[model samples]
Target: MTAALWPLQQAVYAKLTGHAPLIALVSGVYDEVPEDAAHPYVTLGSITEDVDDAHNQRGLEASVVLHVWSKYRGFKEAATILAALDTALDRQPLPVAGFKDVSVAHQQHTEVRDPDPDIRHINVSYRVWLTKS
Candidate 1:
């Protein structure tokens, strides 16, 4: 069976960047944040994948993390961005390369206190299931 992590990440990136509402809320969606990256942006975080094989077919389950960063005074800014991110991916149809029957769902999320008091962060996770095509 083929590895689905890269393709899945690409698909998620495309979905978030291409969504008008989501894009309007953030500077950009990035795999690697730039040194001069702006505030109120989204970054793709770690991924964990596992084998979930079924009779006569190969399946994979992946958990992807997305981080929302904002310099806004309160958690409200990060939360709004989180909502947009969730709406963009949760239960949304994603077309991943080399994979079929793909589905994404919101797993869980939490607020993280950055050491730098000025920064606010919200970490969100999504569960993705796909079958090798």
Candidate 2:
């Protein structure tokens, strides 16, 4: 699944649970840039300055994390939910313009098995970072 979906999943989960969710962003520091880019290249200088300012004003940087759990029998269902969430986020407008750079920092999926297990669970975690505009 594409990395973009975590934020959307977190948003949905938060709405359902009425609590903060944990998500993992899965992007690398040196990931290659696409051959065809639409926007001007962003530099660390701009990102750092903006994040620092935002942090100062908010007293903390803004971020979203999502943790999803489901029975092993429903692993595919869970994945589908996450994928749909990603697509929704891509098509939707940001809640605020301050979120300029929304990127994935890490992602992980784990499964547990037990011989006497009545039901298995699949867990997906996502972490994301955002800088205020």
Candidate 3:
């Protein structure tokens, strides 16, 4: 079995970082946000994979989550970022290094009011399906 997480992530990163709308609206999208990072940025979050042994092919299905962090004092900015994330990944074709027919889609999302009150966060989950080449 092969893990397609890295490849999918790379494709997604490229999409988001290259998007002018997303870039202009937020500080940036990151796999790991740096310390002292500016507000209004997106970060890659947890990923869970489940083995998918099919008829004769080994496959994998994964749930990947992303977090949108903002300090805009309201949900507006966070929602905007979340929309961009959805546009970038939902039903988008992701090219995985060692896999073929990779597909990713927006699964679910949640808006949370952080305890800090000064910050807002939205968590989005994506479902990915891929088969070994």
For every candidate in turn, the CA RMSD to the true structure comes to 0.7, 16.4, 1.4
Q: How accurate is candidate 1 locally (lDDT)?
A: 0.92
Q: After superposition, how far is residue 43 of candidate 2 from its true place, in Å?
A: 35
Can you give the lDDT of residue 24 in candidate 1? 94
Model 2, TM vs. native: 0.35
lDDT of 1 at 19: 94
Residue-level lDDT tens digits of model 1 in 4-122: 87888899999999999989988889999999889999999998999988899999999999999999999998999998988889898999999899998999999988999999999
Steric clash count of candidate 2? 17
Alpha carbon deviation, residue 15, candidate 3 (Å): 2.4
Tens digits of per-residue lDDT for model 3, 19-116: 78788888888887899789999998888889876899888998989999999977999999888887778896677788877788899999999989
Task: Tell me the TM-score of model 1.
Answer: 0.97
Cα error, residue 21 of model 3, in Å, equals 2.0
- 122 Cα displacement, candidate 3 (Å): 0.3
Clashes of each: 0, 17, 0
Q: Rate the local accuracy (lDDT) of all candidates.
A: 0.92, 0.35, 0.85
Ranking by TM-score: 1, 3, 2
Q: Which scores greater on lDDT, model 2 or model 3? A: 3
| Model 3, residue pairs in steric clash | none
